[model samples]
Target: MNPSTFTVMEGEDNERIDQRLARDMDVSRTAIQQWITSGDVQVNGKEIKSNYKCRTGDIIEVVPPPEASPLTAQPEAIPLDIRYEDDDVLVVNKERGMVVHPAAGHASGTLVNALLHHTDALSDVNGALRPGIVHRLDKDTSGLIVVAKTNDAHEHLAKQLQTRSLTRLYIALVHGNVSHDEGTIEAPIGRDQQQRQKMAVTNVNAKEAVTHFSVLERFSEHTLVRCRLETGRTHQIRVHMTYIGHSLVADPKYGRSRSSPLAGQALHAETLAFIHPRQQEKRTLTASLPADMQALLDNLRSG
Candidate 1:
């Protein structure tokens, strides 16, 4: 097993060892505790319990166990809109209403299943659930996503995401007329404790998220806008827009009561740019707004 090391900083002082490790390593606290029980975690060259309070300037080492066998997900013959492809990566213009990968309730007919059928190999860095998936678009949001063909490619793409070098832009039709031409939303996002399925701007275990947007067009009750993500967070644009009193036109999770002509959120990932892992070159790809979104704009223009 490849052992990892970390040093507890002053900001992390007094935190439980397991919690500190979980936050720093982006792993589960339960998993860290398990490693502690197995004597695979040490602080200053001595094994410690999970509940031990960490002090600043402490050196920590973790030797994680070997990963379990990869889970098997059957490949399906679902159609994919391939935008670009090469040996190390593939860019797909995913359609709206298509789940990006498999989950407990959605175990089939996902983009992963389709990709498995289309390609013979995929990076397993994200484990079985999301092989080759460097990032994701919501099921209702359509647009470009890049898939990694090998582990090295996956790591490179993931580093771009972490460094905020990966560029993602979206086009959305939101409820209400936006007054400003452009603005930025800077908020921390975390899961809602009351409603586990929802995310909110909360301080508790929240991560910093920033979204910049510009108004493209205005209508009587809606506005078309372009958004660029500075820091990717789940449902960030949707949540931020809603927080600013301009939820998406048809976002069932965050929109007003009036049903929309479109079935889901009128949001599309319009552009994606990233540095290629193998080629060491920058690549930017774009996808046009889906037919439904375009039709909605046309209707607004005609009226």
Candidate 2:
């Protein structure tokens, strides 16, 4: 790309050159500063510091460097618990604390990193960082998640999820005793207005969320439940359970616990059923509760 020229409009006068260029060119101020340091940005045909204030009618030229790729998702030698794998799909019992894909601040030790190490045949429909990820399991919640080996498989599995044909079942330990044996929670979930890190049941920019739960066991103060999801919203089960006054045990964001032995929410993806993308056959897979959650239950029963 050629150098872009800009004239400092009246309102932008006296603004920092880096800020002005970033706003005008719709690039990051960090990139603008990099251009300034590299002598790619000029004011009135002379290179100037990023802090230089712009004046009205000042001519600025910017030659942006080639767009740098963000951090690459590296393939790590992390072992994956493969539940099922074939030509078109792979299903893995994602363990607790394993992130499903690479993202900001969670670049490594993710399932994607391990998947990359295991196979390079991941579908790129979700882009490089999230290759083959048809859906995601929350970092703290462990369980079965499907990955696509090809773009066609990716689209097929994604359509199943959208149409609610991809069935996902979870085992959740909640804070309070659930009175009913089985019930359905249908609520709208959205990002919490006050708490940026939390999702809440609200109508503001929310999506329809549904969770069907049946009591599996009951303890003195907690209840173990089996939950099936009909919609895959972010934090759907966690938010819906909390909305029904049965927040997951040890859920850092939703539960009231300040300290607990568990690493994260007492929830796990126990079962997953989806049609095989290539074979067109129904596939159902399941995994038992993780050790930590199991230990918690044992202690509760013993007490």
- For candidate 1, write residues 1-303 as lDDT tens digits: 468898878887898887787787777765676567445688897667666998999999988767511234678998999999999999999998888876535668899999999998899876565789888888899899999999999999999999999999999999899999999999898767687567788886578999999999999988999999998888999999998999998898888888568889999999999999999999999999999989999999999
Q: What's the C-alpha lDDT at position 110 in model 1?
A: 90
Q: What is the per-residue lDDT of model 2 for residues 1-303, given as tens digits with 9 covering 90 to 100?
A: 557989888887988887787787777665566567446787786667667999999999887657521335789999889989998999999999998876546758999899999998999875566789888888999989999999999999999999999999999999888999999999988768798467789987677889999999999999999999999988899999999899988898888766677999999999999999888999999999999999999999998
- Candidate 2 structure lDDT: 0.86
Least accurate 10 contiguous residues by lDDT in model 2:
63-72
Reference-based lDDT, residue 62, model 1: 89
Query: Model 1's lDDT to the true fold?
Result: 0.86
Task: Note each model's CA RMSD in angstroms.
Answer: 8.4, 10.9
Give me the displacement of residue 295 in model 1, in angstroms: 0.6
- Residue pairs with backbone overlap in model 2: none
What are the TM-scores, per candidate, against the unseen true structure?
Answer: 0.78, 0.78
